[model samples]
Target: MRYSYQIVVPAATYAPWLRDNEFLTLFKQVKKNSLVNFYQAYELWSLVEQLEKVNGDVLEVGVWRGSSSIVMGSKLKQLCSEKHVYACDTFEGVVKSDASRDNFYKGGEHRDTSQAFVAQLVEAAGLTNVTLLKGVFPEETGHCIESRQFSLCHIDVDTYISARQVMDWVWQRLSAGGVIIFNDFGFPMTQGITALVNEYRRDSDKMVIHNLNGNGILVKVKV
Candidate 1:
């Protein structure tokens, strides 16, 4: 008689359970009351866990009304003591994408937000460590962040040129174990993100791509 031996594996830790629960609760409470959407809230919760692990600064491009930034800032305050959260945006409605390029907002238009409005929301969130950078990304805004480095960078500009500019600007600042999440990766309309990912994959062997909620995440590993 022949006998086979089997090995048992222990259950893996559910890192996102608590965060998801909190997000779900928040979602239920604010789903109909706020302009902030559920998808953005979920993404905020997801990045919060990663930011906690790295204990570094959090940078977000295209902050609208400080919704996601507030979520990230709150988590950063609780998880890391020395880190700061920076939010960049024009504070106006979405800028028009390149006419020659295809992106999620190719034909669509976005409303302009005000810097004062965003600042008010940030203050309301009780986020003392949050810094608001008011301007368009990758242009006048690039000069504001010179030597800053981040552990978690969220790119949600919703256009090819803007997304590419954010990636190029933050790539060097991203820590080796940092994560860069693209908000429109899987959406076919955002060809710019798709192209960016393809180009990024060519040179990066440490990129872990994930498809979640029509978005794409590229988790970078330290060399």
Candidate 2:
């Protein structure tokens, strides 16, 4: 049997307009910054637009209050036809990992946003193609997604074990020329994501790592 592999080099596009103007304007208008992170939003949107050009679906592993998901999913709906965006989260906050795993957050530190809240936000945004999968990553979450490939996957689980598990599950499902953006790449707190990326690169020649915003992106290209 022959295994197929491909790598993609992402074209990094900076939208200064979002930073100096649009995002800031929205930040003030909304009266809260809870749903927006300028850098993450801009970079993800750039990746989404590129993926749209090729007709691809989007998947996000961590969604808090549906802010980022709303942004990306809404844009995807506008740019592509019949393209789906899947958002997976426990909705009950991070679950306890095995004690051996590093970077596991002790209980009670993070807030758990309910599924109802996320659903309300998505509905208010009028996002049609967005699907919400409520559960932990790589386990209950895996059942929610079909076997279809994804053009872009955003992993933001924020811990080493969760990040690695999410990547391991999603990497092979990524289409040729798809991109996997790891949100906690070089951040000292999320060393597992960095370690996983390094290990993946050593095992595959077609993937390229682009470090951005304390995050690392693994782009798949056709070899």
Candidate 3:
């Protein structure tokens, strides 16, 4: 009935980001614009590499400062991939946070950003692969991208209802080998996300992976 908390220290000694000069250089510029930690950012950086052969574009539902979008866009640019990154946000903060399902977030918690701010960040990164969609995702902004399919979706809404809505909406649009990474699944304040991710564990059409860096990775198995 309640969520448990624990610190995860990955046993593996591998540190690929340290050796990745390009990633380091790019992350350094976006670090100040992001709330995502170093480990998680590195994970995002690495995950982009896996989508080389997958069809469809990338989708990010919580573009606070455009850091994650830029990171993925930078990778896609490097790979010379034609895939685009649809970065959606309310530009007004979080929404649909239920007090019963969510512990801390009461909506409008991360309003320290604006569309103009993130746009400038994206422009400064020299990333043209990212398209900023400003509105409530899968609601006001969903129709604009309804025709497109997604290879990877990064959900960081930080509430059970919002996360659930995004998963439900993006499910039909996700390619067979597509991946969905839920950000905010490990923190205590984000217990709602943890609860939401667990609700998806027993499904046959997809597989859920719990990562140490607070990401709930969902892989679609059935096309």
Candidate 3 segments whose C-alpha is farther than 4 A from its true place: none
State the weakest 10-residue window (summed lDDT) of model 1.
1-10
Off by over 4 Å in 2: 1-15, 18-36, 96-101, 107-109
Q: Clashing residue pairs in candidate 1, if any?
A: 91-113, 92-112, 92-113, 93-111, 93-112, 93-113
Q: Between 1 and 2, whose TM-score is larger? A: 2
lDDT of 1 by residue, 161-219 (tens): 78878888887788778888777665555666666665677565358574545456777
Best by TM-score: 3
Q: Which lDDT tens digits does candidate 2 get at residues 39-74?
A: 666677667778765535788888867777776776
Ranking by lDDT: 3, 1, 2
TM-score against native, each model: 0.78, 0.79, 0.97
Instruction: Report the error of model 3 at residue 161, Å.
Output: 0.8
Tens-place lDDT per residue, model 3, 21-117, is 9999998999988877777788887888887778899999998988888999999899888999999999899999899999899999789999999
Winner by TM-score between candidate 3 and candidate 2: 3
The lowest-lDDT stretch of 10 consecutive residues in candidate 3 is 1-10
Clashes of each: 6, 6, 0
**Candidate 1 accuracy as lDDT:** 0.69
